[model samples]
Target: MKGVSTIQSFRVYKHGLKRLIQALGTEYVNLQNVYERLLVGIAPSHRIEAMIDDPFGELWREAQLLGRLRLRLWRSFKNFEDTVHDMREAVQEMMEKLGIGPDGEVEWIEHTSIRRQYKRVSFILQRSNYHDLLTRIREGVSSLQNMAIMNVNMESDRILRSQVRLNQLVNVTSNNIYHALRSTMTCRCQRLHEVGLRLTPPSRTIVPQDSDDDVIKELQFRLIISHMGPLATPSVRQWSEVLLQSARSQVREEPTTPLATKSSSSKKSVKFSVRSSVSSTNEFMQASAIIQPATATFSLGSAAMPVDSGMPQQIRDLCETMQTTEKRRSGDNCGHIQDHMSAKPSEYGVYFMDCLGDCENYVLVPLKDVLRDQSNGTLPPMLYSDKLRLAWVIACSVLQMQETPWIPSCPTHDDFYVVQKGGVPQYQNGFVLKHLPDRGGPGSTSTSTTSSARPTLLSLGIILIELILGQPLESLQPQDTPASQLSPSYEAANKFLGRVNMLGDLGISAPCNVVSVRYLKARTRRVS
Candidate 1:
């Protein structure tokens, strides 16, 4: 009777302890939710003024301090949650050993050894510091809860009252994008350097689809980007010189073995035949022109010619001539090319071998083309999720490449491209091609007053609207108003606000109601 009584007592105590721990965990989670909401609300304004040389330096400092405080509080709450979880587990295990069910019912064990184990476990539970620890955790959680509430209210008030300066926001957002790109290359040894990347028109290769579903599982843009050293700026002439020098060096390092001898003998026999069949420079140029413009329009039924089969004879001859030069320099280790190419920049340098092979395989089609095709019923309808994902990708890309050489000052749908493979567009593989600046042409460095005032942001908003409505920005022009008379900013703003008003009539039931509401609220707050 006494043993049964002891067992019942132990079960009750442990059950109570488990409940207390569970309650603490629930409180911690609620506190965490509050913290997350507060953070999200203030994120837009966070560090937004970092790039601007404004008088709000004190405000920026205060925001940073508050951000740090929130971080520290989150960490403290996480630790408390973990500790509470451990206590709950310990209490549950003690109860289970004593033959107590989850509902606090005791499983009567008649064996003497089992009864003795119950007593042992009960004694350990009593001696344990769980009670003191729970008390401390409860107190800590209470303190955190109070702090979280205070911060949340403080941030909410700030968000409601503060108005972001348009010009400052533009500069800061651009700077933020640059910083985001730099942060992505976490390795201190690597830096983001702009390089000229050329994209050729795509060639279709037919393949069987895994499923008949219209949804695109993945999209890839067939574009190439070269990374020079962190500090190395890209130069077309320098890149070509490096390539030529590397080829020469490779030739000099080749051993004069039996394989080399046979290869050279074979080359001598093929050289005369290649030269005899080579066409005139004018004929080769015409052939090149024919191939270059083939990318402008494509058909589902059309297939590209094989790269080597379509190579002009003159080009092949030039390649052979370069190879012959390399073989001739095989014995001359002290060549000028070696000395010139061996010189390194003060910072680390990584040279990539340029892909001068078949360009048809690396072609990229513009995003506008895909959108047009879809609208014209030439392609499958894009899923809502795909549209959302593409919008997110473009937004991030704008942030990363806004001030860089990769994108123009005001990028449109034309700047973004999609990779088409086997006549099917890879919608997921959309990318932006790097802008190749013309030598002595007007530089892209000069930012006009209008462009300096949130051009990227305006462009981004327009593109997003285009994606949502599955139409180009031009289509949104009011029928009565001539587009030529209005500035692009005014036109886009008028269209966007009109759409927001339409969404307001539809209430919160529309698919993009949340976005519309947020936009309207922000605008309203700014106006006030």
Candidate 2:
């Protein structure tokens, strides 16, 4: 119907459009597959899942539109030349959606799913070869017009292999049972009715299924009670008989669980430790499957520590009490399963303070500014007793069950502004307290253990060390040229310790044999 040249040009353009659609469709399918793998495979709490959600969602929309455009391309054949023009415009639009710059580069800040996925994969795999993987994918897209069918198939196979390897890496990187259990040791442990406060909605008969979410929750409650001790409940004497019967059941089920009735059983029990040996190499360990009642140990101290070791009274009393109480414990549906106490800090228990709360509102100032007028001369050295006093407070708060006495957390010079009111330091004297976090007092939990205090102790320790050293822990980063060789906080304390011969091999010091840095070092080591 037309000249030979015109017919040939239309054919060339139509084939080009076919190649473009095929190439894009392959990419779209692969991207979708990888995203679906991540969405359902990972744990809900993992940060990587949250980071990928938006980018992957955007990619879904783009792919859907591209598919619609590809379908519309066929109807345009009615206008011959117009069909080729429409196809070119659609191709350009898809390319623009990819956010390629005029220079043919993707910006890192654009939050493109491809780039972020590459980053997430690289991070999880502990490798950085994703850049190459991304480049190859881009090159495959660019070569659509000329690339052989064999080449396209080969590229797709390689990308798929990378995706499978990434999934394998994720599985390989999950936490072991011991580590995983320890991480969630202080997490909220509630009963089926306790959390949702209902038995009728997710309706239950008098009989519940043997395998259910409730069963897992029951296992969790027993586990917490095994360590934290039972809260006060009415009819203690009646509860004693129930607990006694439960203990017999546990002993019968897990043959390794010793009978506490026998006085000779102490040596037979597996010793507890701060870092317990993991049960086995299973990918995901259930608390009910691996958690043994006798092995229940709290953090903050050594394992195999004796009862008379002078630990905090509450923790010591708690551990000793639980040792006896749990030995008489029952099965999945036994002792002390009521919501007598709530674990939600904000609701019933105290909500502990956050250190870097609303980081945007904080203002950084040098330490010297606040203490300019505190001393007669160049600020007198802070008393050794003061350091000891502060360190002990944090140590006890962290290690103890209940706070013995409320420890006053003080502000360091560089950290906050000071307003003195008639020789007292507080806002009452006119010191402006800005951007301070509300450290709500801890309320009750399923177990009102010292778990809340643990985080406080760790963070407070860092603050105290910085105050004593008169420098930030992260200040030595500049000197460590091979940065990765040294830890984030270079041991600045060791340098001073070495000078004073604290670590044994005496190097340099006043040799005065007078001033006692011994007390300070002892306190620091104990706190650390």
Best by TM-score: 1
Residue 514's lDDT in candidate 1: 43
Instruction: Provide TM-scores for the models.
Output: 0.41, 0.18
- Lowest summed-lDDT stretch of 10 residues in model 2? 192-201
Model 1, residue 504: displacement in angstroms? 10
lDDT of 2 by residue, 1-528 (tens): 345554464445334433433444464344333333333322234633442333222232232222222222222212322322233344333334433233333332334443353443233222132234334444433333222233333444543443343322222211121112222223232311000000001111111112232221111100111222234531121111111111112211222221112122221111111111132112111111111111221111111111121211211121223324434323212121111112311001001111211112322223334234233344454444543443343332222211211122222223233222233332211111111011223331112233332333233444445434434444533574475633322143334433334423221122211112443455478799
Q: Please, what are the lDDT tens digits per residue for candidate 1 over residues 81-124?
A: 34434433444444444344443333543345645755654654
Off by over 4 Å in 2: 1-19, 22-334, 337-528
RMSD of 1: 25.9
Candidate 1 residue pairs in clash (backbone atoms < 3 Å): 200-363, 201-363, 202-363, 219-428, 219-429, 220-429, 221-429
- Show how many residue pairs clash in every candidate, following the order shown: 7, 10
- Model 2 clash count equals 10
> All models: lDDT?
0.39, 0.27
